[model samples]
Target: MKTLFILFFSIPLLSACSGGASKINGHPNIVYILADDMGYGDVSCFNENSQIHTTHMDRLADQGMIFTDAHSNSAVCTPTRYGVLTGRYAWRTRLKDGVLWSYDEHLIAPERMTVASLLKKKRYRTACIGKWHLGLDWEKDEEGRTLLTRPIKNGPNANGFDYFYGITASLDIPPYLYIENDRVTTVNIDTVEATSGKGFWRKGPIGDDFKHIEVLPRLTDKAVGFINTQSKQAEPFFLYFPLPAPHTPILPTNEFRGKSGTNTYGDFVLMVDDVVGQVMAALDQNGIKDNTLIIVTSDNGCSPLADYNELAEFGHDPSYIFRGHKADIFEGGHRVPFIARWPAKITAGSETDEIICLTDLMATCAAIVGVDLPDNAGEDSYNMLPVLMGEKIAHPIREATVHHSVNGSFSIRQGKWKLEFCPGSGGWSPPTPEVARQENLPPIQLYNLVEDIGETNNLTQQNQQIVENLTALMKKYISDGRSTPGSAQKNEGETPLMMD
Candidate 1:
């Protein structure tokens, strides 16, 4: 105990950001709970007028810091997840637009240092439970076959995790099945019909035990089980629980159905809250609550599958004051709810407006573990530990945060100035560039988010100098192959649409 305390305290705090809670040990159990396609306003704490009652998420807010200006690296599931694990923007990879679909090859390279892999190096038992939208190289029966075969070429297990229990992609994506470690638990493959609207799911192969409705509950149970099991062990563990819920097939269990008094999607959000509660309960039950750093956040904004129109009838706007929704270049697309709780290290019920991206998670964790990330790893990630500890800082943690849309549009934000290389929403939202062209919209857009949070006013024509400066920075970031200061590195693949 004395040794652990001494080692933990030996790392000096930033002089600017002084004072912090006394921690028990240097190593704390890290449970990163990522929600799929959940919007920023879905949480009651984030949105005062939210229709869905997210009690557990609200409770979590009361116990942690609420980041008013946090975002996923991209405005979609797979990309944001890629950024989360790798600390590099997904845009830097070959996939510049859209997401990896069913049976797509694994996104993470074998040699890449993933958050799990980094922790494993530190002797932390790592596990991933829930949705893995990042592609998996499933062992196939033939070259082009979609059928399941044993010994998946790569998955969460292959990347860095010692254990993996989850689906390969979104709940709606086909070939739905659960994988334990490197193998599918059961091969009793069956066909499922494609459905559309509210409870939508693609028609494809499904395992015998895999049910859309049972997935969330099953993941919750597995996460709780993992925590309980790991809590008894001496070595700390890292559990990456990414829930596949409130996305498509918005299945709120029978007890939760119609409970939100808004819509089925609202009901599903409620169910997601329950899942959060269960995980928190597990931590408390196992007596690891204080020493465990748990973060609950979404991959991106609320997907259109939630039926914004239907949700609005109940006086709900998942994007809240933000302009657009998922897959767009707007704040509504990438800006997401971010709350973190670490009783041992972080101040309670605090709030910060520090601009942060999901990609920053890697650097933050690396800082906590006292590991200096190599130049090759977390190239775009920024360490947010100083800000999280409530230390006063001279400037923003991120020099400028980059945002990407599903259609491959790019935007860069530094301070309040934002520059977008797109004329439209840049996703499945209003006035696509094609329509914007016909409507004679500007070829690009810029906004001072400080003056316009809704992104209502376009200041591109008026702010040419700011536009040029931002555009130049964006170009430099691209050519440099990284956002952070490091030796010049080559981007994995060609960046899509260099500039407008």
Candidate 2:
């Protein structure tokens, strides 16, 4: 493992590397702010009639490029997070369906190259702060209880990040203790019961200092401190700021409570917006705003726990015009508001409908630092640096994008067409797989997304050839163990991680 001091000492020599338009100062610092369970319609810029005005997020969009077609690789947290870090789809791994439990072992293979590891290769100091749902291997007692006594094995620190500070999983999950680096911030834990309704969470152990309402603010403060600490350093830093906000335990501070005038969920979103503002402010206060490449997006769509019906009563729809919420094989399930700002390269207030996935972070960063990725790494990543630089691309950057539902349903999108293998929503939404089957729906579904973005109409019967083509492409992606242009690589497991 090469240290930053060793690699960064030769920055002048490395600047000779080609590909990106690197500045004399150095490669731009990258700050990836990932919001958990925030929906496309939650942000005012993405949703015209949105009730919660995400002022900071909207300003970020105003200063950078807003990707209208950006999507998470999966409609869930763990898998989508895996894709973001590893630049590979999580479904290809053994944990086929659903999310990882708090007690589950760490997911990323030890040898895998992650965004943090790659950035560190370029002498960029990497740190991850906030929720890491990708699993952590914890020590256990003879009674089979989790013990956060020592440094976690194969945790974030082991996977490329120089520093790690955050919870193990969603706020709603149990054992609500903060982990800074590999050790617990505090060992004082008490059993806490699950809360019902909007502020819902499973019953679990919680540290004395861990308050549901304070988690968001604590994480934000930590991020600001990190930025302040890095301000004096010449070397650029990479902060993977993943927020566990507006997700669950919908705990909004008193100052933001009732701010949205909609509901607790709406208030929580406003708080999330405040978090973005705080991060941006930190950058500005530290004089790192202009050169920093700030990209903000969500892990997945809004969870139904947001109470859509209640939001509808306030004339606010979290999913916006899209059909379903999270965990479904619909546009809303995966499509998210992706905003990036980099004054050095990206045009201000620019917007592109260029289709992109979170997995692209790896290759884009690699391109920025002028590192050509080996075939084995970033298998599903596509470089959108050109699109970010206002380049007029003649063809789509991706041959087609793949989406996965919580139930492991597969959907492939190319241009305007989207095909799903499951019979229905394939998740929590109505017309579930069972319902669709009972209603005699076809085993597969095809939609012309361009003509019918809502996906209300099924064109499977009329477009057999298109369906076949997409199916074949999906199969090739599976058999070849990758979607991007590369030599055939084997998947981690025997199961194909897809439906016909």
Candidate 3:
């Protein structure tokens, strides 16, 4: 009887120990791929009438969870990226208006916590490959002349990325050269004139050997090479690939050009799809597909140029049912594609409509690593790991999310209510633009997103109670430095306006 009792208890305890010693089944390698200026309707998985078939991107959605009402923190590249990295609103920072230029100083302060820095603490090898629109300090010559040859400072290397190979700003911007770590891979001393080369944006200095047409392919190649090199290492890796495609000067490579019947923009989108495919293939080749968490999303909505003659001519509506594009406070401006694929964790062919923001990545990563975030870090990020795993149903992760426009306009979403502080579209059509001030428009705009996803009807007049409630929520969010997770910090400027 004594032997039997000991054997039974010992057997259960040994099993528990064995299970605890085994590797966590769900811990995954994360790959975040960010698309610049990609629209909600750009992918066929999201839009039924999308002219281009993004097979790889579609496959990702099919195999993973697709978020229907996802958003970036801003409608522009730099702010959105800043929010993603810091898990806080970009408007809270000194860069309250506009984006950082290529020659500008580093946007992310050295002291600020970052997703890369957080991941590095967990022993993850982090790398950022592709367009780094977030500003970096480039080295200058003795005469205060900007030298393309000198190494830069306060870039990804300073921000916690073990390796970084990319550009300072948009591909069209000056100091047009590929930066690897702290130095430029290719330098140009002569002032190169901007030209409409292969339908890409023309500006600043570019090497004669640099082909505007091959930007996507080049970035894709670099990403694949990095993955190949890291696969041999023992540490888990994180790759933050921000692609500069389908943005301005849309230039699809020769192979993808004319393939999508939807014109140049559509063709460029197809090229982006190919890039996704290549990255997926690389993961498979390295036998880490099951353990990797690949997330593909965009910085913001489709640009206004995509809505002009090009969209009408090709029967493509980049914003889909949303009212405005890119810089607007409307859903079309900030709502974007968010797809996550983790074969070992997330369920296949699942879709989650829970409102999520790019800002949550930092907290989610922290949760994955079993690391608790300090109060100052990821103030806005809420861990969505439970939602991603399809576990929690009614328990929402984020209570409210704040969005920023190119012109520094602010909008806040809480539950079903969306509150925009400005009257007319505040961004691309600034007060100077023709559509800036609508004669009869109200000072504030409020919409019940649950009832009106298109934002066709303004509820500021009818729903005074909701407007007041959402306004207070927005104010509390902004005043306090964070929206979802941390305590409210007071706003320093004029008291935030309320519609009601």
Q: What is the C-alpha lDDT of each candidate?
A: 0.81, 0.83, 0.74
Q: Kindly give the stretch of ten consecutive residues in candidate 1 with the minimal lDDT sum.
A: 1-10
- Residue-level lDDT of model 3, residues 357-474, one tens digit each, is 8888888888887788887778788888888778966767888888877777778888888988877676773342235454656677888888898776878988898878877887
Predicted candidate 1 versus true structure: per-residue lDDT over 1-500, tens digit per residue: 00000001112222313222222244666778888878888888999998888898888779877889988888887888889889998888888888998689988888889989998887778999988878888665557665584678778988889999988888889888888988888868889999888788999988998889898899889988987787667566788888887788788999999999999988988888888888878767765566566677888888887889988999999998998889989999988888877665678899999999889888988987889998889999999888768889999989998999988999999999888888888887897756776787776889989989988899988989999999998988998888998987777777855334
Candidate 1: stretches off by over 4 Å: 1-25, 497-500
Put down candidate 2 lDDT per residue, 1-500, tens digits, no spaces: 00000001112223423222233457666777888888999989999999888888888888888889988999988999899999999888987779998889989999999989988887788999988888889988899876766668888998999999999888889879999998888868888888998788999888888888888899889988987887557777778888888888888989998999999999988988888888888777765565567778888889998999999999899889998889998988999888878776789998898899888888887887889989899999999889987988999999999999988899999989999988889888989877887898878888887889999888989999998999999999989989999898888777453454
Q: How close is candidate 2 to the true structure, as a TM-score?
A: 0.94
Q: Is candidate 1 or candidate 2 better by lDDT?
A: 2
Return whichever of 1 and 3 wins on TM-score. 1
lDDT of 3: 0.74
TM-score of 1: 0.94
Which runs of model 2 end up more than 4 angstroms from their true locations?
A: 1-25, 497-500
